[model samples]
Target chain A: MDEFASIHHWTGARQSAEWQQRRGVVLGIGDDTAIVDVGLAEEGVAAPKRMLLAVDTMVETVHFNDATMREEDIGYKALAANVSDIAAMGGVPLHALVSVSVPRAWGPERMRRLYDGLYACAERYGVAVIGGDTTSSPEHLVIAVTVTGTVEAALALRRSSAMPGDAVFVTGAVGMAAAGLHALLAQRVDGAAEAAHPIIVQAHRRPAPSVRAGRLLAAHGLGCHALNDVSDGLASEAWEIAEASGVRVVLHETELPRSGSMAAYASETGMDPLEWMLYGGEDYALLGTIDKTSVIAALELFRKEGIPFFLIGEIEAGDAAVELVRARAAGVSHSGKQEKRVQLAKRGYNHFKR
Target chain B: MDEFASIHHWTGARQSAEWQQRRGVVLGIGDDTAIVDVGLAEEGVAAPKRMLLAVDTMVETVHFNDATMREEDIGYKALAANVSDIAAMGGVPLHALVSVSVPRAWGPERMRRLYDGLYACAERYGVAVIGGDTTSSPEHLVIAVTVTGTVEAALALRRSSAMPGDAVFVTGAVGMAAAGLHALLAQRVDGAAEAAHPIIVQAHRRPAPSVRAGRLLAAHGLGCHALNDVSDGLASEAWEIAEASGVRVVLHETELPRSGSMAAYASETGMDPLEWMLYGGEDYALLGTIDKTSVIAALELFRKEGIPFFLIGEIEAGDAAVELVRARAAGVSHSGKQEKRVQLAKRGYNHFKR
Candidate 1:
C-alpha cells in the first residue's frame, strides 16, 4: 500500500472508535502537522495557543548516502524537514526530540559531527533539543525528529482551506535541490560545475525552511488560506492541496519559479528543468494559496519583508485535480501558439512504492 | 563513550547556550520526560497544565529479534515504552507520533499487524495516534514513538527530587521480564514451559506501564519524590536517582521483589534470580522515594487502592552512590549473619558501549 493509503487505513480505524472523542485535538493525521490545543491564553484573550506536532525521519541509503550527505548535513536536514512541516502550519518551532539509531561502527567523532549538525540547526531555529532516545543500530543509520511548536489557534494554516479564485503562491525557488541532487549523483562537482553551481549543491545539502515567510503569512491570516511545504515536489504538493481542498489547481508552466543555478545545471547536463521542478522533491519551499483580492497586498508585504514570493497558480471551481498550462512551441499544434493543458499526476517520492 | 556520557556531552552544550532561556520549559534533558508549561488554567486557578514530552525507540536485532518479538509485539512495546516514560513523570498520555522504518521485504499484512499493535496500546492508554512518518528500511526495522502527555504543573515528578531520609519504594515485581526473555531465548516454550509459565512469556511480550499507580503517586504530591521507571534494570535506575538527587540509595538484596515464576525459572536454569533482578532491564515498573514520615500513609493508600507497593530501600545522606546490603551465609562470615555492603555499579543496558 502507498503511504496515504496506510495512513487512511489507520485514521479510519481511529475515527470508528471512541478515539475521536479526544479533547484539544484540533487537527490530526492528514495535515503537515497535528494541531493540539494547549489552551493557555493571556487572561481575557480569546485565542488559545495550539501546539503543532510534526515528525520526519531520514534513513541512510534512502534519504542520503555517503556520496550525497555528510554527517552534519544528514542531521541538519532531518531536523529541518520537521521544522518545515511546522512552518507549513504557520507555527513557531519551540522544542525538538531527536531519536537516532547509529550504526555500531560509527566512532565518537562521526557521532559528534552528526550532533554538531543537529545542534547547529537547532540553534539557528531557536529550538531546544529537549529529550530524545539513542540506540545502536546494526546496519543503517536512522534519524527521526519530532518537533513541537505553538501557533495561534485561529491563524493556523490548513490545506483544506483553499477556496475557488484563490491565488496560489510559493516562497523562493523550486527544483534547485533536485538539480543539486542530480549534480551530486553525476559527480559533476569537480571543478567547473562546482564553481558555477555551488548554490545548487548547498541547496540540496541544507535547504532552509521558510519560517519567516510562514510567520508573515500567518500574521496576514485573512489573506492566506492553505499552506504546504514542497517536500514532495510542486506537482505532488499541488495535488495534495487539490485533494484536501476539493478544488482544481491550475499552474502556468512559464511562471514556475527556477533558480539560475538550477537552470544552468539542467542545461549543462541535458536534463529538462521542468521535469525537476515537477517531479523532484525536497525543495523545502512554502506553497500556499492566497485570497485573490488580497494577493496584491500579500505580494507587496512579502516584497517589503524581502521574502521571495511567486504567484504560480490559481484555484478554480472544479473537481479535485491539478492541471498545468504549457505554451506549445510555435506551429507545433494545429492551433498556433495555443496553451496545452496537461493533467498532473500524483507522482513523487513514495517510500513504499519506490 | 557510554550512553550517559554522550548525553551529558549534549546536555552540557545546551546548558551553556542561550537556548536554555526558553520560557515555559519547566525541565529539559536528563529526565524521563521534559515538562513544558502549557499555561492554560481554569479561571482563577493557580497552577497551569504542563505538557510532558517523551520519546523512545526500539531497533530491530538490538531490542528484538523474530525469535523473541512478534510484529505486533514490536509495535506495542515501542509505544508502551514511550507511555511508560510519560508515566514515570506522573503524566497522563494523550497523543503519540510513531515513526517506523520497516524493511522493504515486509508485506502489507505485516505493516497492518504492526499498526494493530500500536492502536491497541494507544486505545488501552487513551492516547490518540495523531501523526507519524513511515519509511522503508533496507535491513532492520526501527520504530520510534514520541508521546505527549499532561500533568499538573505542581505535581510533575522528576528524578532530582529524592532527599535524604526518604523511603524508597517500587510498584510490582522486578525482573519478571528478564526471566521471560530468558525463557524465550532458551526456546523453552514448547510444552512444559509454555503451559506452566505462560505469564513469564507474556510479561516479556506485553509489559504494562504503571499509569494508574503513577497518577496515584502524583496525586499524593506531598509524599512522593524522585520517580523513575525501571527501563534499564533496578541497579542502573537506582544509580540514576542517586546521581540526579545527590543522595545515596541503599537497598536490601532480600527485599527486592520477585515473582514465583521468575524464581522457578531461575532455579530451573541454575541462574541467580538476584542477577536478573539487578541488571535485567525492561521491567517498566514505577520506582521512587517517598517522605519518611509519609511512607506508612502512602503504603496504606496503595493497599486501599489494590496496588502492590514494596518498601525496598531508603535514601541516605551521602554522595551520589548506590549500595546493596546482602546478609552473609550463616557459616561463611567471621561474625554470624553479618550484613555485607556492596557498591552497585552503573551497569545496565548501555546502548553505545554494548
Candidate 2:
C-alpha cells in the first residue's frame, strides 16, 4: 500500500529502451514534471523550447470533503496543484485538460460553480482550458487535471540537479496551509477556529503557487539549482531532492520560516508549529537549492523582486539523506546548548499508505 | 442532464477572447481533439507541426462494471478511447499521462494488472507513458488519460470539413462491440451467450482503434476529408459531422456493414443489429467523409494498405441533419418496395443523460 513503492513498481515495469530512446523525451517519470522536446525548432535552428507535462488527481473523501472544502475551492485547488508542479519544473503553464467524474447529487448548478472556480484560476494564470472529458461517478467525485507548459531548453529545474555545497532555500512561509486545515478541522468541535483564523483557512482552501518566483529562479540560471514544490511537507520534499540528487540535505530548525498567523494559531491550539512546518503539507511553496557562491546574488534578486526567500539549510557531500539540525535545550545537552542532527523520515500525504 | 447541453453551456461560459485568440490554438473545445501550433519553426521557416491533445475518463459502474469489463480491459479501453480521439484528428499519439483513482478493495495486484493493459496499449501505439498521478478513492475506481500527439500543420482532419457531394464512409464493421456487450449481458440470464459468440465478445472487450487508417487518410490529403471516431455510434457521429459541417447526411441501411458473429448473435438474441449499429456506441471505428471526386482514389489507397473501408452514405446540401434510407418490404410498400427516408435522432451514450 506504500504509494512510492507502487509507483516504483509500475514505472519500472513499463520502462523500455523504446520509451527511453524516444527522440524528444528529455526527462520522463519520477520528476516533478516530464520534460519533452516538442521539436518546435527546425533541425539546425535553435534548440526547441521543451514542454513540461504533469497531472494531479483529487478524490472526494481522500483529498477533500464537503466540510473541509467548498465546491468551487475543490475545483480551484485541483488545478492549482498541477500548476504548482509546473512551477516546480520552472515552467509557464499554457494549457490544461480537466477530466472530472461528477456525482449525480452535485447536479448542474454545482458543476457550473466548480467550473467557475476553474476558469477564475485559468484566467489568473493565463492558461487556456483546451479540452476535457466529463462522466458520472456512481459515488465520489474525482477531478484529474493535466497541464502542459513551456520551459526554456536546458533551464528546466529538476530534483536531481542539486550539488554539494549548495544552499537550500524556500520561498515564502511554510505550515500556513497545514495550520489552516487544522483550524478547519477544529471548527467541527468548537466552531470558532475558522472565524478566528481566516488567513490560514483561506491558505488551505486556495494556495497561491510560487510560479513567478520559480520563473525568476530559472531565468537567473543560478549554479546547478534544484527545485521542488512543497506539496508533501518540507521534510518529504527535502528528502526527494536529497535522494534524487544523491546528496545529503541538512535543514536547520531555527531557519524554517513560519507565518505570524500560523504561529498564533499553533499556540492558541496548543500545538507545536515545528510539527506542522516539517510534516504538514499542501503549502505549494517553492523549495530549492542554489550553489553557495550564487546565494548572495539570488537573495539580492529575490529582495529586488519582493519575493520572500529564506535560506533554510545546506547540501553536504554524503549519502542521500535528509537531516534536521535541531537546537537542544541547555539542560538537556551534555555541553551547554548543542545542535542535534535528526534523520528525517519520508513521511507526508502518501495516498495509498494513508 | 443532457451531456451535450451541459458541454455547450460550460464551453460557452468559459469562452473568452484571450482563450480564443491564444497564439497557437488551432481548435479548442467541442472537437475530437484540440490542435496547438506549438510554435515549432522560426519565422519564415517551414510551418511547424501541430500538436493534438485529448482526454477521456472511465468511471466504475458508469462506464464499466465487473460483470462486463476485466481490470485490464478497463485500463486498455480508457487509454484506447483517448487514442481514438487522436486518430479522429489525423494525428499520431506521442505521449500520455494517466491519472487513476483506485478503490482500496482492488489492492496493489489489481492496480498493477490495470496498468499492464495500459502499458500493452502504449507499446502497441509507440507512445511513452510519460507521467501520471495515482490516488486512493473511497469507492469507485476512476481512470483518466490525456494523450498528446503530432499532426501535419495543415492536413489534420476536422469534423467541419465535409461538403456537398462528399461520400460518407466507415472503416471495418459497426455494432460488433455493442453486440458483444449485449451477448455478455445476456450471459447472466441464459448463461451461454458469451460462449456462443467469442468473436463479438472479444470485440467488445478490446475494440481496436483505426490509427493506421486515420494516418493513411491524413497522409493522402484526399480532398478536404472530415473525420470522426465512432465512440458514440453511427447515428450520433453522423449528426456531429452534419451539424459541424452544416450539411445533410444520408446513410443507406443496406450499406451499414455488420460482422458475421454480430449478425449471428443478434439473431440468437432476437435483437435488431441495426439498432445496435446506430445507438450502442464504443465501436472505435473511423467514420468520415471524402469528396466524391476523390472517393475512388481513397478506396484504392485503402485497398493497397489492406485496411477495411466501406462507402456507407453521401453528404448533400441541406440544413444540418442526418437521415437514413431504408427499403420497404415489397408487400408493405405503398408503391412496390419504395425507399423510405427517416430522420435519425441524436441518440448515443450521453454521460450525463445516461
Candidate 3:
C-alpha cells in the first residue's frame, strides 16, 4: 500500500473548505503546481509587489523523538520555525508548501492529526497550505515547509543595516525553550508541575513568534535597520547580526532576560541560567536594533499588547565582534567610589562542531 | 562535524554573481527570507503577476541507495524532480529553497561536492538558490526543495482542461530512465555499452526537465487543453488526465515508444518492455492533449529542434476510465480479418502496496 494514501485523502478532503477562504490563489492544489495570485491594490489600482520566501526542515530524533513528542507537536514546530523566519523579516506569511518523507509505519489517522496540527497553526496565522509533495522515507520522518509572504518595499528590514548607536532589544524572554528541552531530556517534568511563573513547557512545544512586535518596529520607519529571530540561541543570532552589520555588539550579561521556569530549573539542577539564555536555541524570539529615539515608542506599542520588550545592549562602531560583560548597575556608589565589571567570551551552538 | 558547512559557504558564495542574471529577485541568499520582484509588463505597463510554488522531497533508500549512487547524483536528482514540476506548469522558475537533513557521519567535503552539483543544475535552469535550513538527520539523508516560478495568465495550462476530441501526445521517449536504473541494478551496464542505444546512465542521474518543450506548447496557444509530466509512468499520468478531465483515455499500446536499451534489456531479462513503458517512473517527459489539427504543427516544431514527439492516443466523451489496446499500423488495408489485438489492464507505481 502507498504510505501516503492517508495524507493524500486527508489533505485533499479536509483542506478544500479551508482553502476557499484563501484569496489570490489561481490554483490551490491537486495539480502539477500550485498558483497564487499576488496582485495587491494601491490607491484603487493594482500595484506590483515583492514576495518573501523561506523554508525550514525538521527531522526525527534531531528535532523530536517519536517516543516522547506527539505527531501534532512535530507538525506545529515545523511550521512555526518557518513562520518565525517570516516574522524576522517583518512580514505576514500568506502561503506554505510542505514536503514530507515518512516511514510506512505511520498510518492515515496519524498523518491526519499531524495535518490538523499544521492546519491549526496555519489557521492562526491565516496562511494557506497551498501545495506540497509526500513520499516514503527509509527510516524517519522529515518535514520541510516553504512559506511565501508579501513585504512593503520600504518596510523590509535587512540584517546588515544596523547602525552605530542603535539600541538592541528582544521581544520576549529567551532560553525558556532550551530549559524546557533540558527538562524534557532530564525527566524533570514533575518538579515544574503547575508552574505558571514561566510557560516553559509551552515554550518548547509551541513557541510563539514575535510577528506583531516585528511589524510594529518595521512600520515605525524609525531605525529598523536590523532584525532577526533567535532560533539558534541569542549568541549565535547576535553574532549573525554583528557580522552582517559589521558592527560591534556589546551586551550586558546581567541584563539578559531569564524566565522564572528557567531560573527555577537551573537552581534545581545547579546549572547557570545565563548559559541557557546565551546558548539555548529555538526561542523564536525577535531580536533587533533601532535608533535610540524610537525605543520609547516601540516599548509603548508592545506594552499595549502586554508583550515583554527589554533593552539589553547597544551597537557600537567597530569590526564584526560581540562582547559580553557584567556591567555594574547604576545605583548606590560604593565606599571606595569605584565600579568594576568582568568580561566573558561568548559561546553558542555551531552546526559544524560535533 | 557538521555535514552542511560547505553547503552554507557554497550556496552563499557561488550564488551572488549568478543571481544577477536571474530577473525578479530583489534579495537572494544569506538572509532570513528571500524577496522576489514579480511585477510584469502588461500592455507596455507594469502589472502584478501570479507566482507558482511547488516542493519535492527525495529520501535515501526510497530514491537512492548510498552504496550505488554518488552524493552529487543524489543532489542533482533532488533538484531535478522539483524543476520538472515547474516545467509542467509552463512557467519560468525563478527561485529555489532547499532544506536538507543528513547524518552527522557525512563529512563537509562530500557535502560541498554535492552542492556543486546542485548549483550546476540550478545555473543551467536559471534558478536562484535562495534561503533554506540545514540540520542533522537521525539516520539517512533527506533533501527537500521548494521552487518558485511565474506564469502568464493566458499561457498557464491545467491538467483538467482536456477536451473530448483532443489528441494525446508525449515529448521524447519514456521508460529510458527506468531502463538505466534496471541496468545499474542488474550490473548489465557494461554489456549494454556495445549497443549504440540510449541506456542514458545520465538520464536517471540528471534527468532534464522538459521546460523548453512545455514552454513551446503553452506559447503556441493552439487548443492545448491539459498538461502533465510523465513522472509516474504513462498509464498513471494518462489515468490522472482521464480522472481530472472526466473523459475516457484510449491509448494504442503498439504505438508506445520503447528505446533500444529498453527493448534489449527486456529481451535479456524476459520482461515485457510494454510494461515498463506503461509503468516506468521518473521519465520527466511532458504528456498532454492538443486539438487534432495542431498535432502536425506541434510535431513539426519539435522535429525542427530534433526532439521526438509522438501521438499515440486520443480523448473521447465518456466516464473517467482508460483503455489500452494493440493498435494497427497506418496504411494496412488487408483483405483478411483485421481484428487481432489484446486489451491489458493498467498498472503503475503506487505508494501504498508492498
Candidate 4:
C-alpha cells in the first residue's frame, strides 16, 4: 500500500476521545498542541484553562547533517520545527524544553556550539529553553524539542475544523528543501567543489516559519477553518488536510509556487520541477484552508505584510482527490490520476514510505 | 574529555542573563522550563498563566529493542520516559506530543500497536497526545515525547534548589531497568526460552512513571530541595543532584534496596551485582533531596500511601562526593572529579556500543 493508505489504515481504528477523561488532556491527538485543561490556579471558574503543548525530534543524519551544518543552524532548525506546529494552530509559542542524545566522541566545544545555535534560534523566535536532559550515546546525536503555546478558544485553528468550500492556501514556496538536498548531495557525488552555491541550500538548512502569518490570519477574521504546517511537502500534506477535514482538494497546476532554488535544482538534475515543489519535506511553511470568500483579502493582507504565499486550490465536496486543471494541448481527455498525481508523484514524502 | 566533562565545559562559560533577555527569553537554560512570557490571553487573567513543558527522545536500538519489543510497550515506554521527567520536578503532567520516525517496512499494524501503547500510557498518566509530525526513515524507530505539566508558583522543584545539608532520598527500587536489560540480554545470549515471555519482556518494555510520588511530594511540606529521576543510575544521578544543589552526598550501602530479580540477573551474567545496582539506567524512579529531619516521616507517609521509597543518603557541606558506608562489604568512596562529576564510566542501554 502507499503511504497515505497505510496511515489511514493505522489511524482508522484510533479512538482519540476515549482517553479524554485522563486529567490535563484538554485536547487530544487531532489538534495542534494537545490542549491540556487545568484548574490549578483558577477557583470556581466555569471553564478550564486550555493550554497547548508539542514535541518534535531531529536526528543527526536523518533530519540534518552534523558535519557540514553550523551548530547554530541545527539548534535553530530543531526549535523552528516545533514552533511551526504552534503557528499552525494560531497560537503564541511560550517556552521550550530540550533533550539531547550526544555522541560520546563529541567534545565540549560541539555542545557549546549546539547551545549557541539553540540560543540564537530561541531568541529569534521569542521562546525560552526552560528545561532539558543530556546524556551520551555511542552513535548519532538526537535532539527532542518540546514547546508550549496558548490560544484563545475561539480562534484556535485545528486540522479537523475545515468546512466544505474552504479554499486551500500555502505560505511561502515549497520543494526548496528537496531541491536543496539534491544540490547538497550532488556536491558530494563527484567530489565537485561547491560550485553551485544556491539559495536552496539555505531553504533546506533554515526555511522561515510562518508564525506571524498564522497569527495574522487568526486576528483578521480571515475565515481560516483548519491549519497545519507543510513540513511534509504540499501534495502529501494537502491529502492529510483533506482526509482529516473530510474534504476533497482540487489543486490547479499553474497556481503552485516554485522557489527559484527548486527550479534551478530541477533543471540541473533533469527532474520534473513541479514534483519537487509539491512533495518536498522540511519546508516548515503553513498549509491552511479559509472560506473561499476570504481568499482575496487574505492574499492582500499577506502581501502587505510582505509574506509570500498564494491560493492554490479549493476544497471540494467529493472523494478526496487532488486534480490538475491543465488544458490538454492535444484534444484528448485524461485521467486525473495520470495527468495530475503521477506527474507530482516525485514530490510526495511520507514518514513511513519516503 | 568524557560526557560529564563535555557538559561542564559547555555550560560553565556562557552563563548570562543578557543572553536570555536578548533571545526574548524570560527564562533560559538552567530552569525547569524556560519561561518566555507571552502576550496576555484574551480571557483576561489577573496574572500571567505559567506552563511547564519538556521534551525527550527514545531511540529504537539505543533505548529499546527493535527485534522483540511489542508495539504497546514501545509506545508506553516512549511517553513514560518524558513523563518521568515531569514527575521528577514535582509537577502534575498535563499533555504530551509525540513525534515518531519509523522505517517503511515496519507496517501499519506496528504503527497502530505503537499508538495503542502510547494511548494506554497517556490515559494512565492523564496526559493527552497533542500534535506531532511523522516521517519515514531507513534507521531504527525514534520517538520524541514532549510533555507539559503544571504547578503553582511556590511548588515547582528545580535542580538548582538543593542546599548544603539537605537529605537525599529516592522513590522505589533503583537499578531495576539496568538489571532488567541485563537479564534480557543474558537470556538472549544463553538462548533462554523465557526471553519470549510477556512479563519479563514487558519489564524491559514498558516503564511506569512515578507521577504519584511527585504529586505527593509537591503537595506536602516535606521538602525535596533538588529533584531528578534515576535515569542514569543512583551514583551518577546522586552526583548530579549534589552538583546542582551545591552539596555532597554519602550513601550507606545497606540503605540501597535490591530486588531478587536484580540479584539473580547479576549472578547469572557474572557481573558485579552492586555495579549493576549502582550504575544502571531507566529505573524511572525519583531521586531527590529534602530536609534531613523529614526523611523518616516522608518515607512512612509514602508507605501509608502505598508508594514505595527509601532514604539512602545525606547531603553535606564539602566538595560533592558519595562515600559508601560498608554494610556487608567494603565501602566505596566517590567524589566529584575536576570536571565536577562523580563519573560513571558506562552509559546505560546503548545497543551498538561494544
Candidate 5:
C-alpha cells in the first residue's frame, strides 16, 4: 500500500483507556496544561498544588532511517512519536518546546523547511511551540520536541492497565512503513503503483497522530484495557502490553492486515512479510484492548468518525508469552488467521543485536 | 575545582521571571505534567488549548566531556538540564522521552548507567520515563530530553519585567564553578587543593537545581521585576536583564561574592581574580531584580525561609550594559564611581571561545 494508505491502516490499531480521578493530578493528558491537584499543603481543607514535568526526542537517521522518506513526513513522524504517549493517557496536548541539532551543511533554509514541516504536524494535531533550545551539531539533523499535556484528576492512562481476556484491537494496518522501506530499497515500480505511492514515503517520514481518536476513546467510557503506541513494531508492542498487563496475547494470523506492497516487498526480500508486519518498526500507530462486547460499538464509532479500525485479536488466558497462531485452510501463509502452527522467532527487536 | 563546581557557578546567572497568568494553561513546569486547559468539545469553548511541550539537549564536550565525566553524570546532566526549564516556568514535570546519539565505542554498561542516572534524577524529581528513540552517531554522545510540564494557566516568567531602579540580587554564590575549573585544569596544589577544593569541583559536576527557589520566587508577591539564571557568566546574565528590561546594570565589584576556593583558584592561576569573578560561568545562582521598595521585605521573607541572597547591583536607565565599580579606590576606566567598564566580551565565560 502507499504510505498514506499504510498510515490509514496503521492508525487503526490505537485505542484509548479509561481514566480515574487520582490525587495530585488536577488535569491529566488531554489539554495544554496538565492540572495536578497536589495533596501537599493542608490537612483538612486547602493544599497548594504543585507540578512535575518532561518531554521527548526523536531524530532522523539517528532515531529513524529515511532511506526513502519525505521531509514533511519526517516532521510529522517526529511529533507524532512524542504525542502517542499523551494520547495513551487521554491527555490534551498543550504547548511544545523544541530543540534542533542540525548539521552545519543543512544551514538555515533547510532548517526553516524542516520547521515548517514540524509546524504543520503540530498544527494538524492542535499543538503550539511555546519555547525551545537550538544549537549546532556535528552531523545529521536532530529534532527534540517536548509536549505538555493535561488530563482531569486521575484520568491518566498507564501501560499497567491491561487485564486478561481484554480483546486486542488495532486502529489501522501494520507494517506499512516497513513495506514502503522495502519497496523503496528494491527500486521496483510498475503501472500497479498508484501516483500517491510517494506519499507513502512521506508517511514513513511523517506519521500524523490520532489525538482525536485518543480523546474520544477516553471520553466514551469504552472498555479499553490498556494502551501503547506501535513504534517498535506490533509484535514487540504486543509483548509490552502483555508484560505490562500481566496477560498473554494470542494473535491469530488470519486477522493480520498487510498491504499489497508490504507483501510484495517481503517476498522480494526473502523474508516473511508477516514478520515485517509483526516486527518491523516506526509505524507510530496505537494499539489497545477492550472488552469483547464493546468492540463493535467502538468500531462503529470509529467508522462514523472516519477513523479506521480492526478487531485483530483477542486477549488470552494463561501464559506470559505472545503466541502467534497460524491456522491454514490453504497452502498460503495469510497474515493473522490461524488454526495451525508455524515456526516464529521467540523475540522481537533488541538493541544489543547487530 | 571539579566539573560539578563549574556547572553550579555557570547556572547562577539565571533568575525566575515574575509569574504572570495567561489564558488556557491549567498546570505548568513544577509538576509531573504541564496541564493546558483547552476546549475539546465543539460546545465547550471558543478555542481549545493545544498540547504541552518542552525540549532540552546535551552537547559533546560542552555539557559532558566524556574523557573525565562518568556515564551517570552525562545522563543526569541531560535529564536535569531539561527539568530545569520546566522548573523555571513553575510547571509540573511529567513523563520524559529521551533520544541519544553516541559513538559506537560507548558500551551497554555506559548506556545502562546513563539510564540509571536518568531514572535516579526522575525519581528525585518525580517524573516517569514514557518513551524515546535511540540511534548511533559517528561523533560525540548527544542526548536530548524533552519534558512536558503543565501549568494551571498560561502563566510563565519572562525576561521582560525589570523596571528601572530595581534592586538586582543573586541567590547563592557566583564564580565558584569557574574558579574550580581554573584550579583543576591548572593542576594547582596537590592534596590540599584536592581536599579543600572538592566542593567547587562537585558544584561543577553535579550542580543541584534551584527548583524550590524558582517556585518560591514565583509564588511570593515580592514584586520581582525581572529574573534569569546564571548559566553564561554573571555579566552576560546582567546584560540579558538590562536588554530585556530596557535598562543598564551597575554592579559593585566588592559585593560580588565569590566562594573561598573560587577566590583562591583565581589567585593561583595568576588570572585577574576579578576577571574570574565576573566571567567564570556555571554558577546556577539566580540573578533577579526587585522593585527598590520590595527589597527589604523580600530579604525579610528570605530570612524567614533561611534562603541566602545578596544585593549585587542596581538597574539604571541607559543603554543595556553592566558597569563595575571597585570598592575604596579611585581608578577610572569608564564614568562615575565605576572603576572599570565590564565589556560583554571581556566578561563572563564564552563557550565558543573558551
Candidate 6:
C-alpha cells in the first residue's frame, strides 16, 4: 500500500483518461489541488451555471462486512451512493473525490480489489476521479466520496417543489437492497444459505442507481416537481419530500411495489413485505411528485426509456406531514393475525442513531 | 448518540446563516444537493473564472488520539487541512462539505465540540459549511472534508511551474506543528506539558493555513510560479514541486527557518533541529518559488501584511531532485564529529503507509 505513496496515485497521471468528457475541466487531477473550469459558456451567453455538489460515506460494520460483502461491491456501493445523489438532483455527475481509511489487515490485494470496484463504477457513470485523500486506520475501513455535477438553473429539481395535486412517482422497485442485506446478515459466511437468496444478495451488494431515468426527468422539465433518491426507504423519503415541500404525502400501501423474491421471502419468513418496502432503506430508486396533468407524458417517457415508473401516491394541501394508509389486506401479522389499517410511523435505517 | 441524528445537524439549517457571501449560490445545504452558480459574470462579460476543488481526510490514531487531541482541535484540524488545499491553489474558499464517521464511545458532547471547532475555523475564512454526511462507525473517528473555492483563471497557481532561476519562498516558519504533537504525546492530558510548550502544542493542534498569504501571491500575480501549503514538511513538499515542475531545488541548511523553541527542544533532546525543520509535517505554511526579479515586491507585500516571508532555497537546472546542504557547522555529531554536506533523502509524514 505504501508503494501507492499517497492519494494522488489514483487521481494522478495513472488515472485512465476515459471519464474526462466535460469540456469545462481545466485540470482533472495530479497536483497539490484540482482546478475545474466551471461556468464556461459560449460567446454572448451568460456566465456558467451553478454546479451540484454532494458527499456520502460508507463504513465497515455499520454499512457492510467484508466477510459477507465482496471487496469490489464495497467500492461500487460507496461510489454509487454519491452518484445516486447527483442523479437525485437531475444532474450529470462529472467529477469525484474519494477519501479512504484502510485497515492494516486488508492487504494491497484487497485495496486493489476495492479500487477496482470503485473505478469500474466511476467509469460506468462517466465520473472522473478528480482528487482524494488516502490514509491507514488502526481498525476498520471507511470511505467518503464527494461528487460534483452541472445543472441548468431553471431545470434543477428540489424536494421543496412539489405542490398540491401533484402525482407521486417512483422509479423502479424498492426495498430489494434492504432485503438482500438482511439475507446476507442472516446467513453464515458459508455459501449454501446465500445460494437460496441470490437475487437479494445481488440487489443488496450492487444496487444500480437510476442515473438515466433521473437525467430523463431532469431534461424533460415536463412536470417533474420534487426529486429524491430513495436511500432511507420509501416512507422516509416520502416524508422528506413532504417536509421540504410543506405539503402532505398520502400513500396507499397496496400501491407499494414489491418484487417476486420479496413476496416469496415474506411468505417463507412470515415477515410483512410492506414493512421492508416502506421502512428498509438503500433502494437507490428515484422518488418524487410529478404534475397530474403530465402523468401520461411522464409515463410515456419512462416507458420509452424502458424504466418502470410507479405511481405510489400524491401530494395534498395540508400541514407538512407524511401519511401512509395500511390497507386491511396489506398483510397478515407475523403471528398470522389479520391486520387493521393504521398510520405508518416514520422510521428508516439511521445508522448514526446507534 | 441518536440524538446527534445525522451529519446534517452539524451542517444543517441550525448552521448560522454565516459565510453566505458568495452571490451565485443557487442553493446551499438543506436540499437534495447544493447548487453553486459557477462562472457567473455580468451581461457581456466573459464567463466566470475557474473554481478549485479538493478533499482531505483525517483518521483517529493515524491522525490523532482522542486522549491527547481535544475534540474541538480534531474538528478544526480536519477542516483546516482542506482549507490549506484551497489556499495552495491561490483560491478563496467559498464552501465546504464534510462527511464524518463517529464512534459511539466519542459520545454526543464530543461530537458537538468537534462541529464547533469545524465551523469556527470555516467562519474565520468566510467558508460556508454547505453540506455533509454523518454516520456511525464501529471504531475510530473519521472526517473527510471537500472544499470548493474560486480563483481567476490566470491567478490560480499549480504545483508544477517552478522554472530554473526561481527563488523559493515560504510564508512563515515550518515544522512547529510536528514538534507540538510530539510534546503532547509525550506528556499527560493535563495542561502542564502543553503549557510549558505552548507554541509547539498550539501549532500542532490548531495550525492555521496561510490563506491571506496565498491569496496575496495569487491575486497580485507577483511572479509566484508554484505554490503549495507545507503539510508534509519542507523536504517532501519541495520534492513534490521539483518532481512536478521538473527542476532541481537546492536548499541551504543554515537558512532554514527555526524558532527558539525548536532550537531549545533539539538541544535538550540531543536531536538535530534540522530534522524537524526538514521533515516535521503539518505546519500549513505556504511554500513556493517566485521569479528572482520579484523578491523585493514579494518581501514588501508579505511585510505589509505582517506575515513572515523567508527565502530558503532556489530552483536550478538539473534532473528533478531536491538537494539539501549541511556544512560542518550544521550540528555536532553524537561523537562530537563534524558532519559533511549531504543530499537529504525524501521522507515525511505519510500516514497511508503501514
lDDT of each: 0.84, 0.84, 0.68, 0.68, 0.60, 0.74
Error of 1 at B296 (Å): 1.2
User: A75-184 in candidate 2: lDDT tens per residue?
Assistant: 88988998999999888888888898888788888888888888778878877888888888888889999988888887899999999999999997999988888777
TM-score of each candidate structure, all chains considered together: 0.94, 0.95, 0.82, 0.82, 0.78, 0.84
Q: Which 10 consecutive positions of candidate 5 chain A have the poorest summed lDDT?
A: A11-20
Q: DockQ for each of the predicted structures, in order?
A: 0.56, 0.67, 0.20, 0.34, 0.22, 0.21
Q: lDDT by residue for model 1 over B258-308, one digit each (tens)?
A: 999999999998999998888888888999999988888888889999999
> Candidate 3: lDDT of A296?
85
Model 5 lDDT vs. the true structure?
0.60
Instruction: For model 1, state the Cα shift of residue A304 in Å.
Output: 0.2
- Clash total of candidate 4: 8
| iRMS of each prediction | 2.3, 1.5, 15.9, 4.2, 10.6, 15.4
User: How do these models rank on DockQ, best leading?
Assistant: 2, 1, 4, 5, 6, 3
For each candidate, how many residue pairs have backbone atoms clashing (under 3 Å)?
0, 1, 6, 8, 156, 4
Candidate 5 per-residue lDDT, tens place, A176-220, comes to: 766655555545453222343554444455665666767666664
Give the distance in Å from residue A276's predicted Cα in candidate 3 to where it truly belongs: 1.4
Model 4 chain B: which ten-residue window has the lowest total lDDT?
B336-345
State residue A186's C-alpha deviation in candidate 5, in Å.
4.6
Model 5 lDDT tens row, B41-72: 23323321222446567777545554334677
Segments in model 5 whose C-alpha atoms lie over 4 Å from true places: A1-55, A64-72, A152-157, A185-196, A264-271, A327-338, A342-346, A349-354, B1-55, B79-104, B112-139, B146-157, B186-196, B303-306, B326-343, B346-353
Error of 3 at B242 (Å): 1.2
Runs in model 6 with CA error above 4 Å?
A1-48, A189-194, A329-341, A350-354, B1-48, B327-340, B350-354
Q: Cα deviation of B330 in candidate 3 (Å)?
A: 18
Candidate 5 has a DockQ of 0.22
Colliding pairs, model 6: A39-A48, A50-B36, B39-B48, B180-B200
Residues B73-101 of candidate 6: C-alpha lDDT, one tens digit per residue: 98888888888888887877766777888
lDDT of 4 by residue, B221-252 (tens): 78778877876677777777666766777776
